[model samples]
Target: MKTAASSVISDNDNTPAQSIPRSPRLLETLLANLDGVVYRCRDDAQWTVEFVSEGCLQLTGYLPEELLLNQRISFLELIHPDDRQMVRAHVDDCVRLRRRFDVEYRIVHVEGAIRWVWGRGVGIYNADGEVEALEGFMQDVTERKEAAQALQEAERRYRSIFENAIEGVFQTTPDGTYIAVNPALARIYGYRSPEDLIVSLRDIRHQLYVEPERRSEFMRLMEEHGSVSNFESRVYRRDGDIIWISENARAVYGDAGTLVFYEGTVEAITERKLYEAEMRHQATHDALTGLPNRNMLHDHLQRAIQSARQKGGLTAVAFVDLDQFKYINDSLGHQVGDELLKTVAQRLMSCVRDSDMVARQGGDEFVLVLQNQTEGDVGIAEVMQRILAAVSRPWQAGDREFHITSSIGVSRYPTDGKDVETLLKNADSAMYKAKEQGRNNFQFFAPWMDTQVSNRLEMLISLRRALDQQEFKLFYQPKLSLKDGRIIGAEALIRWESPEQGMVAPDRFIPFAEEAGLIVPIGEWVLRTACRQNKAWQDAGLPPIPVAVNLSPRQMNQALPEFVANVLADSGLSASWLELEITENVVMKDAEKTVATLNTLKRLGLQISVDDFGTGYSSLSYLRRFPVDALKIDKSFVRDIARDADSAAIVKAVISLAHILNLRVIAEGVEDEEQHAFLRENGCDEVQGYYFGKPMTVDDFTDRLRKEAVQAAP
Candidate 1:
C-alpha cells in the first residue's frame, strides 16, 4: 500500500511513481475543496512550487497549472512587494525549528488587486530527517486587517486630546486618590510633573484645598446633583501658594449606576478676583491718601446718625480744616503738602476711638464721626484737643522741620440738625469761624453763623462770573533807580472792577480764585497781557525797560518757565525785557526743584528776583544758591527803618548782603524822603513805592512814561 502523504499528488501522468503514494483520490479531493491552497516547493531561492491544489484559483485568482512547477509564475511572485521578506523569514525559521510556519501577509492577485492573506507551511523531510521541499496554505484576511488599523487610529486621537488640553483635565477616584492627570493639571497645582502630583497629593480634601470645607462642599454638591458647574474655591498649590480656581465637574458612574470616579476641568481665576478687589477699593477710598472718600463718608455719617438715634446717644460731626495749609502749600510745594496731609490723616485716626471714623472730605479737609458720645461736647472737646496737639507736632521733609495745625468745628446731633446735609453745613460754617478766630482752635456750631457761610458762598459764585464778564484790569507802578532817580522798570499788579461789587482789591477775590483753582488761567492771562503791553510800549518808540510781574505761589511751578517763554514769543517781545518776581518763601520751598526751574528761566535771558524778602523763613545757605538777579525789600522793614534800630539794621544788612552776592537790592514802600535817603545811603540799587510813583492805570502809566521820555531827551 502507498503512503497517505503521496496520495495528495494529482492524477496527471507526468510524475514518477516513487514520488506518489496510494489513496490519491481522497487526498486530492480534500486539498481541492478546502478554503486555501496547499503547495509543495523545493527549498530553493524562488520557493518554487512543484505541486499546487485547485484552491489556488480562489486564494490568488490563479489556477494551479499557472503557478505550479514555475510554469507561468513562481509562488514567491504572488507575495506582495512589501511582505515578501517577512514571509520568507517566517518560512525559514519554521524550517530550522522543524515545525510548521504560520503568518499573515499581503499578496498580489491575478487581477492586480492587493489582498491580505494567511499562510501556513512546513518543510518536508525524508527518513534521514533532511529537508526535501516546502508546503503551505494561504487564504484572504483583508477585512480583519482593516478593522484592526481603524481601532489603533481611534486610540491615538484619544491619547492626543488627553495630553494636550489647555484646561487642566483630571480623573480621580471616589476615595480621593488621583487616577489620571494631564500636564496642564500638573502646572495648575505648581507640580514638577503629573506623576509627582498624582503620587504626592493623596488627600484631596486636606492637601489640595486651602480650606478643607471647600472639598467637602464640592462632594456634597456632587452627591445631591451629580455635578458641579462653576464651583469656585481657594486652593493650595504644591508649593503652598494660594490661588482661586473655578471647576466644572461631574460624577462618573459605571453601567450598573455605581459611582466610579470624578472627572473635571479646572481654570485659574486669581487675576480676575484681584481686579475686582482693586476696583472696589478704588470706588470707595481716596486715591491720594487711601482714606475713606466723600461717598463712603456720607454713608458712614448716616449710619452713625441712625445708630445714635436708636440708642438715644449723642453724635458729634466734626469738620476739620488744616490751618495755614494753603500758605504752606504755596510757600513750600505740593509734594510737601501731600505728605503733610497724609501725616495729618494718620494723626487724626490715632486721636479717635475704634467706634469713630475719620474721612477725607476733599483737599485739606476731613470729617470725623464720633458715635455714642453721651458726654456731649466735653468728650468731643478732648478729642479735638488731642488732634490739635498731634497735628502741631513738627515733621521733617528733606531735612527741613515743619509744623501744621488744624481748626475743627463740632456739631452735635439734635442740636445742629437731624439730617446729614444740615449737620455738614453747620460743621462747615463753624469751621470757617474757627479759621476766622486765628485758626489752631475748635469752635462749636452756633445758629447765628449762617450769615458768614452765606456770604462765602455768594462770593465764590460771583467770582466765577467775574472772569467771564471781563471785570479784571492791570495796574503798573514805576520802579526808580536810586542813583539816577529815573524810572527803570514797572511792576504789573492785578485789580478787579466787579459789576456787583465796585473796585475789589486783589486780596478780596484772589483767595477765592486760588481756592477754586482758577488762578492758573488768570495768572496766564496776566503774564500774556503784561508781555504784550511791554512790547506795545517799545514799539511806540518808548524806553525799553524790564517789566516786572509778581508770580503767585500757585503759579511758581515747573510749567511756568515754558509758559513764560511761549508768552514772550507770542507777544514778539524780547525775554531780556521781562522780570519775574517770585516771593522769597516760594523760592525756598523745594530748593532743588526751584533751582532747576530758576535756571531754565535764566536760560531764557529773563530776570529772576526774590520779592518780599525777610518776611518768610529764608535760609542763608539756600539764598546764596538761588539763580536770582535782584532782591526786593518788603515794606515791613522799610516802614520803620528810620525809627526802629532793628529795622534799620535789617535793611542795611540785606542791602550789603545782596551787593556781596552780586544781586541788586530794591526797597519797596518808601513813603518819605528820610526812608528814601536811608535806603539810598545803605546801597539800595532801586526803589518802588508811593515816594517814587503809585500804582496807576495803563493810560496813566503810559502818560507818565511819555513825560519821562521827554525829560530825558535833553
Candidate 2:
C-alpha cells in the first residue's frame, strides 16, 4: 500500500534526479503531463533552484533552463514586490516549525503583468540540522483568487443595498418559508425586527399575504421568466390590516442550479391604489349629489336598452322636473333651493333599486334609468309613481315645513324611441303634459301628446320667421272709464296672422312664446309698435288713451328697463302715454329684482298696473311695496261673479285691496250687466270688457273713436 501511494505521489510530482529510482521515473512522467511546476531549491534570500519543470515557464513566463540549479534567476525574484515580505514571513514561519508551508500571493511576471500563485513547500532538513532544500509545487492560481475577491465584493455591495434600500428585501424558501429578511423587509411585514419577521413569518402564503394565490402566482412568474417584475398583491400586516405591495423578484438557485428559494423586494402602493379608485369614482359621479351623473346615465341606459331589446323586456327613461321650482328658488334663495334639490335627490334615489340610476340632468331636472322589467310600461309607471310620491313628501328646511311636487314623464326604450336623444325629447314633451295637467302628476306619452309637440315646434318655427316677415301685429283693446264711458286707455295685445296658420290668439300661443324665450323680443316689438301707433293716433286727431301693453314675466326680466326706455325714445312717444300691464305673479317672481325694475320703469313716468290680480298668491302687505299705479281684477273672477259668490267675494276683495294699496282698479272680463253692476257696486275704478266694447281691428277701432268723439261734442 505504501509503495502504491508513493508511486502515485511520484507520478504527480516528477522532477529531474541523478538517482535511478523507479518512483522518480514515474514522477517525471506525471510532471510532464501536469499543469504545475515541481522544484527543489536551497533555503536562502535568493533561493537557488536545483531543478524546475516546464510548468514554471507557463506560470511566470520564463524558461525552466533560465532558473534551474542556480544558473540564472532564483525563485525569490518571481514574487511581486508588495507581497514578497508576507510570502517570505509565512514561508519562514512554516519552515521554523518544520512543517509544510503554504502561501498565496501576487507575482510580477517576466512580461510585467501581475499574476497570483499558490506555493506549497515541505522543508527537507539535513542530519546536521541545516536546511537542505524546499521541494514543493507551484501553479497559476490567479483566476481562482480573482474570482473569490470579486464574489466577496459583490456580497458586500448587496448587503449594503439591502440594509439601506427603501423597498423591502427578503429571501424565502421554495415552500413559502421566510429564511432571511432585511430591516426594510421587517418593517414592511410589520415586525419589530428582522429576526422577528423571519421567525414568525415562516409560511409566507398563510402569515404574510392575504391571498394564497399571490404566492402561487409569484412562483409561476419565477418559473416562467426566472424572475418577476411589478408583481402586485395584497398582504396583511402584523395587525391584520391589509395593504397593497409590488414586488421585483428572482428565483435563487443552489449549487446545481436547482431553484431553492425566492429573493425579492416589495414597495407599498396602498395610497396610489386608493387615489386611482377615487379618480375613477369621481369621473363617473356627480360632484353635487355624489350620484351617477348624466355621463354615467348614458352608459347605464344604453346597456339597459340593449338588454331589454334582446330579452323583449322593458326599460324606461323618466325625465323628472321639479314643479314650481323656479318660484321656490326665486322666493327662498338658491341655498335653500340647493338643499331642497339634494333632499329630493336622496329621496328619489331611495325609492329605486341599486341597479337603477338616478341622475341629475342639471338644476331641478333628473333622469331616471330603469332596468329590466317583464311588465313593460306597467312596471315603468309604477316606478315613476313611487318616485313621485317619495320626492313630493313634505320636508323640513331650517324652521319651515315645505311641501314640494314633481312632474314625471316616462318613455320606454324601443317602445317610445330607440335612441337616447329621441327618448329624452319624448319624455320632456310628456313632462310638459304633466305640467299642463296642473303638476304633481305623472304622464305617459300618448299619440295626442305628439300633436302638442308638433304645435310647439310649429310655433317656434313661425316665431323665428315672424320677426323677419312682420306677420305679428298689435291690436288695441279700449279701456273705458266706468263713470264717463270714454276711452281712458287702450291695451296693446299681440295678434299672430302666420302665412301658414292665420289668426293665432293671444291665449293660444302666448304661454308657448313665454317658454321659448321668444316673448322678450315679441313683447319689445309690441311695446315699440304700440308707442308708435299711440303717437300716430294723436297725430290723426284720435284720443291718446295711454296704450297698455301686457308684459310676461320672462319679458319683464329679460328685457332691461333701458331697452324699454330706448323703445319709447325710438318711437318718439311720451313715457306717460305708455302703460305696462304686469301680472301679480310676474311682479312677485323675484321681489327685489321686480322692485328694482319697477322703480326704473316708474322713473320713466310710465304707469304700471298689476294684471290678473287676486289670482296668484301675493301677500296684501307685500302688494303695497310695488311701484305700480293700478290693479286689474282677473277675468276668472269676472267669468263667474254673477253665479259664484266666491267669485264676487274675490272681485270685491281685490278692489278693496287695490284701494288699500293706494292703487286704482280696473275690472276685466265684464261681458254682461251682472258683472258690470257687481264691479260698479264694489267701487272698481274702471272696467274694460265686452260690456264696454270688444277687441276689434284698427280700422273699426278708429271708426268707433269717430263715433264716440261725435257723441262727446259739448
Best by lDDT: 1
Q: For residues 236-308, could you state the per-residue lDDT of candidate 1 as single tens digits? A: 9988899999999999999999999999999889976774455445446654566787767888999988887
- Which portions of model 1 show Cα errors greater than 4 Å? 1-83, 95-168, 183-196, 237-241, 267-279, 302-312, 411-426, 444-714
Question: TM-score of model 1 relative to the true fold?
Answer: 0.53
What TM-score do all the candidates reach, one by one? 0.53, 0.50
How does model 2 score by TM-score? 0.50
What tens-digit string does per-residue lDDT give for candidate 2 at 495-573? 9998777898877778688779888888878888888888887888976678898887887663568888998889888
Best by the TM-score measure:
1
lDDT score of model 1? 0.86
Kindly give the stretch of ten consecutive residues in candidate 1 with the minimal lDDT sum. 3-12
Clashing pairs in 1: none
